[model samples]
Target chain A: MNREHDREIVRYRAPTRINHWIVAISFVLAALSGLALFHPALFPLASLFGGGPWTRILHPFIGVVMVVAFVLLAARMWRDNRIDARDRAWLRNVGDVIHNREENLPEVGRFNGGQKLLFWVLVTCVLVLLLSGLVIWRAYFSQWFPIGAIRLSAVAHALFGLILVCSIIVHIYAAIWVKGSLRAMTEGKVSYGWAWRHHRAWFREVVSARRRAD
Target chain B: MALQSLDIVRRSATTTPAPQARGAHSGQVAKLIDVTKCIGCKACQVACMEWNDLRDEVGHCSGHFDNPPDLGGQSWTIMKFAEHEHADGSLEWLIRKDGCMHCADPGCLKACPSPGAIVQYANGIVDFHEENCIGCGYCVTGCPFDVPRISKHDRKAYKCTLCSDRVAVGQEPACVKTCPTGAIVFGSKEDMHEHAAERIEDLKSRGYANAGLYDPAGVGGTHVMYVLHHADQPELYSGLPKNPVISPFVSLWKGAAKPLGLLAIAATAFAGFLHYIGIGPNRTDEHDEREAEREAQRLRAEEHP
Candidate 1:
């Protein structure tokens, strides 16, 4: 293991890490199948799921898995991801944060404003996708609805799906860009130096809470 | 079956272009329905059911003359009745045959994700190959005319094929063969247009000044045309859209939005890559490590001192 791992504090627990990966992997599968169905150009991607028919058959099932995993993951992280005055300040200084001018920005907690906003965006998109998907799910529920409503739901499903995909792209990028964030999810720990530089407020809290427990 | 293969002009989710080498002698066919002459006899509905061998569950009359209520996997055709009152205290019973329009620009074909599930013939008939259907129902949302029904039994989409099977053998559709009145006509689209014009003229002569044909240009015209007495007000005939086109939302979701969404995702990754290249990983250096160590040391000292 790297020396950084030796000097690390727990960021995500084992359950949270496992829950996050389940959501992430499910999202990737769902997005790929959804893209294959969305356009002819990407139809070849369906081959990864056995073929077009199988892709269609599996996409909604994968979505259900993703949504369930996400709910569990979100329930745990929701408190940390809540936006506050400090998060607002962090958002205002996003340019500095992006450029690694950490001293010029607010002290970030477990999640900064961008991450909090992304969390809520994902929640909203997933909910809309589930609702709209049911209405347009021809095999089961579509006959019960008016055609006009199904048409609207189709459009809404596509739009929300696209938004969720784009948001996840950014989420993945942020994890990779922030240096030690991947380890927090993968190994459930982050170096003290990493915690101090990126999430100083969270680092302080963790240290104080440890002292109190001692 | 081989001849049927030669006629397909478009196939949904198909990569290569469909066969287009057929000679110019094959005329495009059409169905003409004269709303002015219709008496809502429901014979066409009966003929369609008989020809297609579909027996939908007998449904109760749900406060409307339209039986079997709405289109379904089995019920390909229905007669819609609208009671309209003219400004001068005259009540008119307007009856329209509602089914697939067989559009030149079929939204169902455009939106369908499964290959060979929905196909358009060169003769202007859109047909569904049920065996290839995945039953995702994108076609249902894509249809501007609100056609296409997914069966509860097999979960495959169904719609008016314009009797492509019958047409393949050079016979008129069963509905046209069975209509008591000459309200339903089947011929070459060119011939049907001419017939519709004559019918419109007769309707105009009968004190219907606004009589015209309903072949909406918004869907790039349809194989099925209707000559209506109140043609100017199509919505009066049981909410037939006065100006029907594929929904703009559907268009955006299926059209430019696809490429743009892919581009947005790609651009985001590219931006992230560029940011990483420019700034490198924001790894904590020796100074950061020292500072964190010092802070921890201070916290420990304060706790124990």
Candidate 2:
């Protein structure tokens, strides 16, 4: 109990956890409605959102909510997610990390290299999706653009949406793969042992702060 | 639609083939417009409005012979009037009937995301089932000739159907029936082509050397075609693209992108499942706690020393 890593430690604040869940919930909704409009085979999914018309009506608005929520979440965590030379070294040992050979890897900080990469990829995908979404948003903005541009934007929107969906799947899988990680977002805390094993540098920073407080 | 017109060969946003045990016995129908003989009277336009039971308000004119200005929810068809000057300084009024072409490969149907919203009959008339239309306006982008306007009232797409309703009843479209100059003709597509050939010959004899047919094959040819006196200059009449095809982007969007994008998403999810099976969960065990305590001790000693 004398060791800081032997006890519980706060990983996320309540506001951040709430914001993350908002982004997650909104993203699932937007993706479902978007996929409904993406292909005819998935058209049946539109019924989940009240039908095709409602899916079309609510998809962009849902996307906006997710984007707005993610912006806040990303802003709150971006400094910790910044990749450095140490992150590159951790990336080189990704196979070992996957095999549970944490001893062979460099000390991970707040986020691993994979997490940082996914974060940046998500940022790019969201930016593209929002812009292209505006260009093809039929009820409103599409009328302002030319047919050629609208057609192109529709294609771009689908492409980036696929990337976003895939990235999120990986994001969720990563959270599940690392035990005790889900609690960080769900309960706003993590076992200090889990933090020290996965994010040793960050665990040390937290301990140094605790020392300063004392 | 009438029961007789139930032979939908292709439906929008549908992957499976349509039921085609019969139908298509009448061959494909077509409407031919001879631009040289069009007097810009707009009688066909009025007839379309009367037959369709739509009345676009008499909007203010923009100093052109074209009135009710452009096609809209109520106006399915319109006469586009263009003033032209020949190289020899001869003025000719080029009048064109502008509406849906009823493309053999309808782009609106191809791009539509709502099942049964847009359909193509076996006889080649592309029709919109407004009841099923979600009105995302994808058809407007899908069109090669830029037809298919959405109604502000109900947010459903509207365009000329080549008057499939009248054709099903064995009658000509109201526009074709009302043309005063014998300029607008309707028949089987083959007969219309033969008629256009004879008209082209007559125009060539009268010194319009460029007179030809405007049945562009880029969209697999359209059910509605034009016999333009200056066929070489189709753009002179309006912004008619010389060679219109479904935009490459639309093809990519609704075509390969669909199955491939879905596949990529599924593969990502499946990969996660496989990873779970391969590595199991990375749990923080008692050994991990001991390791963390050792590291904390090392950190404390480094700080104190």
What's the true lDDT of residue A124 in model 1? 97
lDDT of 1 by residue, B51-81 (tens): 9998999989899799988999999998998
lDDT of 2 at A171: 89
Best TM-score among the predictions, by candidate number: 2
Which portions of model 2 miss their true places by more than 4 Å?
A: A1-6, A210-214, B1-4, B297-305
Ten consecutive residues with minimal summed lDDT in candidate 2 chain A?
A: A205-214
After aligning candidate 1 to the native by TM-score, how far in Å is the CA of B109 from where it should be? 1.5
lDDT digits (tens) for residues A43-113 of candidate 2 = 99999999988888899999999999999999987987888999898888889977888889998888889
Candidate 1 on A17-117: residue-level lDDT in tens?
88999998999999999998887878889899998768888988898899999999888888778899988988898889888889898888877889999
- Model 2, range B1-305, lDDT digits (tens) per residue? 33544588999999997765658787789999998898989899989988999988779979998887788889999988888898999898888999999989888999999999999988889999998998799999899988889888888899997888899889999999999999999999999999999999999999999999999899999999999988988998877778889999999999999999999999999998998998788899998777777776777777777
DockQ for all models, in order?
0.61, 0.72
Query: What C-alpha root-mean-square deviation, in Å, does candidate 2 show against the real structure?
Result: 2.3
Worst 10 residues of 2 chain B by lDDT: B1-10
